[model samples]
Target chain A: MNFFGIPDIYLVILGLLFLSIIMAIIRVIKGPTAPDRIVGLDTINTIVIVSMIIFGLAAGSVIYVDVAIVYAFLSFISTLFIAKYLEGGEF
Target chain B: MLNQLIDIVIYILLAIGVFFNILAGIGLLRFPDVYTRLHAGTKCTTFGSIFLCGSVILYGLRMWILGNVDGSIWVIHTGIALVAILLTNPTGAHALARAAHRSGVKPVGAVIDELENKPTKKSANKMEAKK
Candidate 1:
């Protein structure tokens, strides 16, 4: 028996996560400055990774978690690159 | 009775995680400046993700204890992913904050500008040339 008496628990969590993503997207689109957009994007990348994990649990597929792990590293790299670009640093 | 207790604890963790995530989203939209927005967006989501993944780890642990062989691997892998998140999230936020500051996104309604008063690389070079 599930805790909340719900058949599929992860699905509900996924819905909320999506709503959060939408809110973040609003910030990204309406952001007045470059750093604002960058912040939004960084937040989105994180939420996306979490959602990937939840989706893996929902689907009962182990591969999805693996994908999430890879995605996390890639996103981290991208964030660093974007930050470097923002700072006008060489290389 | 024991199983129900575990379930309740997991549910609580999940709820807390989701609530903080929602707050992060709202803060991103409502905060007035880039710095405040970053403050809200980064910390809350990182905190929320910890709980969310912790709940999953609990579930995996429960499954393993129930004698599912695959549960062990699942738990280990999920733990690895959680560790990755814990390691990466804060570093990214620090980088973003530094970049935002260096790129000249000032905090809103600020009084003093300490970093601004300090000489930048270019200005320092000019100072050296004049010496």
Candidate 2:
């Protein structure tokens, strides 16, 4: 089956990903401690990267997957820096 | 016939990946403490991304064999992305766990606190500064 010329399965998978993202967002908002929020943020980043790849495939474009690669590295760096800041020690 | 079989395999991979990704989200919400939540968030997503990216790579490979040059690019780049995810996810989780512990987010209901008694470098440094 297809919707608007895109395969329906792709749309279903994307919707599920969105649901997971929303769940992570809830955790970020409700988390009591700083680390809890950071964990939620990390989950969100990974999910977004996966969805970006799926979107790239569905759209028949290589650029999105390339962007996802760049995003993966940047997010990893950010997560590390945030952890360092929370540790309250010299970098 | 072979093309249809490949399509089926791709679908299965996508399904498995999405299920695990959703599980990660549920785990994040349900787990009580930061450590447990990180366990859920980091590991599940990493596993899920593996399958998800694997499916994409497989699709690209099929396309490349079918005379599409872009498929080769897709496969190579997706493989790199998967590697980046695999390398970085666990490292980031380790950092987050260490930071959480150092920042005093203790695990819930723990009997033995081995690391608690141990003097970390940060504390040793503080002692030096005070002298």
Candidate 3:
């Protein structure tokens, strides 16, 4: 439906989220250490989930909210894995 | 009139959520050390997510009250996601901080090394007992 159906407020929030993602990407690109990148990625993951919820509302779909939940689980697992790797622990 | 009030509340939540999230991004970029970056990156985003998701839940509840079936489902699922975020974010941040410390990514500026000494002392005591 684009902007025709949804309120302008959702659009503005989405724009801000996009900006947040961009800043996190900058950190991911230039982070000096591995943990820094991981931290940035984690931030991006959280913001992405929030945006997904907003997008679901704006676009009039419940599926996006479901997707956001699954994304949250997967990203949490990935963050744990990366942290373990950084810690030099086995498996 | 009630709907208008709800919209106003939603807008306020959105503004606060978006502001903190943007601040998080800035902190991630500007903070010097990994610990400092983690401090900024993890906590602010979690805080922002709470308000953002909360706003959505409120919207969903308002709609559900108006007799929309989809609104009920949205409220439940969004809630699940919010809980997931709350559970995962802090633990992940803790893990990250520990890993950073254990991997020898020292924080910028001078430090007392309290943690450093405690671990080494324990190890030494264990070794001496073994001997």
Candidate 4:
């Protein structure tokens, strides 16, 4: 009933998260504009952070949640940088 | 009995979070143009993350009340992560929206844009070049 020591409910939640990530990736692939793709990327980043937290809970570890925190900030910075680049302005 | 109640609450929170996330994904696919997609992608995910992280925090609190020291760490770190998400999600969305507008992506079916004639730094430069 346990896969990699994760309970069934947590596994289900993770699977659903994966599905949502796939959907976001689809948008990324099909988007016509750069900003659209960036939007999809942002969504994926947030979902990935949530999934990491769930995995941390399932595995009874704290490190994954900590990593998720770092990932969130890094992704936010990257999003802003990309936005600035799209704006085509200095810095 | 109390443990069961706590578990039920956690499951409810998780379900709510997952539902909103799925809705966000669907919205991203279904919405037209950049602004609407950004609307879907940003607000839904931020709301979902709140509930998801809330569940984890609740679970950690439950464990702590049961005398487990590790639960404190879980609660603290997850809370930090939640705060990080809360702080960054909207700011990033706003930046993206502004960038989209500045880069000339217009909203679908809009009759007028109020910011079009507004004098931003870039627009000022354009005006100077025209003169």
Sort order, TM-score high to low: 4, 2, 1, 3
Each prediction's DockQ against the real complex: 0.74, 0.92, 0.73, 0.92
| lDDT score for residue B85 of model 4 | 94
The worst-scoring run of ten residues by lDDT in candidate 3 chain B lies at B113-122
Residues forming the 10-long window of minimal summed lDDT in candidate 4 chain B? B115-124
TM-score of each model's chain B: 0.88, 0.93, 0.87, 0.93
DockQ of model 3 vs. true complex: 0.73
Give stretches of model 3 more than 4 Å off: A1-6, B118-131
- C-alpha RMSD by candidate, in order: 3.1, 1.5, 2.7, 1.2
Off by over 4 Å in 4: B129-131
Over the true interface, candidate 3 deviates by an RMSD, in Å, of 1.6
Instruction: List lDDT for all candidates, in order.
Output: 0.87, 0.94, 0.91, 0.94
lDDT of 1 by residue, A1-91 (tens): 5744435667788889999999999989999989899999999998998888777776777788899899999999999999989988467
Tens-digit lDDT track for model 3 on B69-93? 8789989999999999999999999
TM-score of each: 0.91, 0.95, 0.91, 0.96
